[model samples]
Target: MSHENKTIRNTAPGHPRRPLADRIALVAGATRGAGRAQAVELGRAGATVYVTGRTTRTRVSEVGRTTETIEESAELVTAAGGTGIAVPTDHLDGERVRALADRIDREQGRLDVLVNDLWGGEHLLVGSVFGKKSWETPLADGLRILELGVRSHVITAALLLPLLIRSDAPLYVEVTDGTAHSNRRYRENMYYDLAKTAPIRLAFGLGQELAEYGGTAVAVSPGFLRSEQMLAHFGVSEENWRDAIAQEPAFAVAESPQYLARGVAALAADPGRAARWNGKSACSAELARAYGVRDVDGSRPDAWAYFEAAAHGGEEVSPEDYR
Candidate 1:
């Protein structure tokens, strides 16, 4: 991918097809998972989207172990409707993120939406006691997760704040794993817990800071995201993913990355989103009710509700009741 955010004109199927027409958005870490889905959804809604990640067709990031590339995500965004530009960037590097800002200024003039979904801690989760005990885990591994999962987001927001503030009602989305209440308990792993929870606080902080400027920030948590990484780890495809439920009971209510993407798009589309949701954390089910969008299966899965009561609270969860 080039540093120049060139416009790509291609067609993708399954467009949600709303009217973001002249809107411009950036999805950091858009190689795969929620990042890719959010980028594509923004494009489907008719917004020019800049898709950024370290993984490109030529090379892969150390944190990711797959063939997925930011170029592919950009192409999908183009196919959906709006222009998609791929930019390979490591958010941890200040100069790299600064260059992204310069490029956006040169290419698009300003940014209307920003989704900070940079999480590449997957490599640390395997064979390691990542969640069982924080201090027991390797210090190097723990620090690495904080660097990739948390610090990158902090750096990105600082650099891009200028572009974001230029918009009429800029929407800043901090993508985390769980809601504030849901993540109250230690997330089985210390480093992972800190990495995920920081974004929620970041959103609240940004919300308070950006209010007078007509910008809104909200931390968005996805419920049991059936992301590409999750699918591969479970050794199952989307069609046969039910097999994973047998292996882990929590998989029963898992939703796709698109579910959260829809939530992001809905928040961006709402005119009063800044007033209504500023400083708060949001979920897919909440957005579905507000925006009236559903998943690919035409059902809105409330994974967090089911997960909270079933997985953690020891209550039986019905898919219909939650969805």
Candidate 2:
């Protein structure tokens, strides 16, 4: 375990606040992308965030990217104004997850927020599942997707919910790829579809159980996110993201990871979140509009809405309108 403990302070000079100062949060699979951003934003709101992933400074997970690690995420969380603890964990391993729960119970006594964002199956998307039929897809790769996206979340929630329920009002966030409304159509492959939709069902089921304890559960999705991997796929960087629009016009509505992070942070800080969001499915755009939050670039992009509109032969409005 690596710890980054700092005296809690304001997020910026002369703007002191700690809306979630007393909160304890665990962000599973926070090595990079949306998970890392979620951890950083929760820390910015003054929550003690435990960032966990299979990757560390000394090791790399099957995702095979070593540029970002859990240790780095913890440091960023601490820099964002809250305590950050990095624990190297494999959510798929039941024993390791149980040990993590025991450690958190020993230290924090209670957990206020649980963000299960443990999907690392992006590498299997290209030739494995996207264009191939289920029968043509590799059996091992198909099953691995389920393990990463669905089983990992189940194990984490099962091991950690005991501590989470101890809180006065717990918040369980199931981070998936699409909203319930958007995923109504087929997602190309059987395994991929099930993996993405499982969290929506999980959130619905958990909401019912958590309601008795004054807890809230919701699944959230980010629109066409311009994550590090996405940028690499387009052969562009954040500063040059607009260049990718020539190849993929839809990229015009792509949002930064910070956009979704801000939305999640606002949701966490909202006093009436249980009444407004419990058992619901939300996207970054919906949360941004609801919370009056904006992306780091000051625009609000609704990629999901834009896609839905385009799917119905409605190209009347440009992608710029969505932003």
Candidate 3:
């Protein structure tokens, strides 16, 4: 399918107002999945979006997947009714991130929204990691996860906040794996847990710092996200995703990436977002309830709640109840 068609294929009817019109946003690591969806949703809300990632038409990064690229993400953003600029960047490289910041400052003068969604460590979860103990997991792989999930966000924010603070109502979103409350338990392995939870703490600290400048920072996460990589792991496409539920019943509550994208876009456009979300951690379901957003299928999936019920509650609960 064409980029435009694919981009809008799952988009539901949006708000009538262009709440983010004339605003500028940068979606780091927007080559695919939730990152790409957020870029497109921000664009749909009428913001000029700058998308950055290591993958491009000409080069591929360690993540290894090349089916999606930054150029395509930019096109999808533009096709959704806003300006899109694709800049190939490796967030781990401070020099490259600094150059990106400089370019954005030169072109737009200010950035209203910064989405730090730069994690590509899934490929590193090989035989040594995932279910293995911390000591059993390769030290290199653990460090790499931290580098990709934690260090990259720090680097991007360090370089880009200058331009972001120029806006009157700046918003910074740290996208990670789980909500603050839900992630209290271990997440598969030690390295993975730390890699995911660091963003929440970063958001908490940054929110306090940004408050002086009238900016908001919050951590947002998707619940059972049906990302491109996740779908591939289940060996099913979106069209046949339900097939996997037979093997993994939890998949019944899985949601499209667009669900969280819409929630983040709505949160960005909200006039009182700072008062409601600053320094807080939220999940896609919470954002949906706060913003009156629903998935493209017209359902609000609360995977975390479902999991909680399944784990602790006594009553038999169906996953469909969460959706």
Candidate 4:
């Protein structure tokens, strides 16, 4: 509930101008990481963003990290030149989500965008090291992860679809991992893989269901995102991120969550966005290259390319590798 981090800057040079003025957006899991970044970018693009999350100034979720609050996220959105509303909500509760939608309908009458970034997997992964088999992970913990990661998105969409349909160009962005063709067995964990894939499937189902409604739905993944939690896990700041790569090589190829945020904003602004829907998943690197946008570091990290290279026994790569 503080505006301490509210700062504004002019749009980046050579980037598209704001095209979402007066639009209403709902970013469902905007406490941190990609959700927070995307919500701020949407606000910068001139959309009133409703940031909903389990964590507020008064409550913290199971994630245990408190780098940002829903109120802080909303303030950042407002500072970016769009109205920001922080509504505390847990997507698992159907009534709570319905109430959120009701409030939006009463106030804004419609919603133009919906971003589902609900994920609470870190809590479930506790006590299960990488060496442990999938069965060693408790079934209850696995189900909890699925409930938070996947079912929450489903519930939020069901409640918000009415408002989204009211817009002439409704956009649904399901924050996920990897594009459709990625075949890697993500860390040899079945629950983790399922949790990550659920959002993509949600996007696919939503796209088909909303095709006739003139709305677009697609899954998007950030390219090796250096989220606040990840940075902390590696005990490194953005300025010192390169130092952590010695221990976790993936850090060398990381991109900020803002990169994907900008990508989502660009897609939301596209008039022909519907053409890119229909169950397809896209990554920030691919979207940036296609749309001529660059990350804050002035590089586009192709996640698929990096994984493909790694799969084929290539050496550890960095942002320079992509350029």
lDDT of 4 at 188: 55
Clash pairs for candidate 4:
none
User: Model 2, which residues run further than 4 Å from truth?
Assistant: 1-16
Instruction: Estimate, for each residue in 43-147, the C-alpha lDDT of model 2 and write its tens digit.
Output: 998999999999998999998988999999999999999899999999999999999999988998878899999998999989999989999999999999999
Q: How far is 79's C-alpha from truth in model 2 (Å)?
A: 0.4
Clashing pairs in 3: none
Query: What is the TM-score of candidate 2?
Result: 0.94
Tell me the alpha-carbon RMSD of every candidate. Answer: 5.7, 5.3, 7.3, 7.0
Name model 4 segments beyond 4 Å from true: 1-16, 126-129, 183-187, 312-319
Give one digit per residue, the lDDT tens place, for model 3 in 1-323.
Answer: 11221111122334566667768899999999899999999999898999999999999999889899999999999999988999999999999999999999898787889999999988998686888999999999999999999999999999998888777778999999998899998988999999999999999999998887778999999999899998999999989999999989999999999999999999998878888999999999999999999998999999989988897565589999999
Tens digit of per-residue lDDT, candidate 4, span 1-323: 33232222232333345678757899999999999999999999888999999888889898886768999999999999778999999999999999999999999887889999988667566476244577887788777877887889889988899778777667888997777766355645777778788788888888987776667999998877889888887899888888898897666678988899998888888877898655679888888977787888887778667777775557565645764
For each candidate, the alpha-carbon lDDT, in order, equals 0.85, 0.91, 0.91, 0.82
Q: Which segments of candidate 1 are over 4 A away from where they belong? A: 1-17
Rank order (by TM-score, best first)? 2, 3, 1, 4
Write down the worst ten-residue block by lDDT for model 1: 1-10
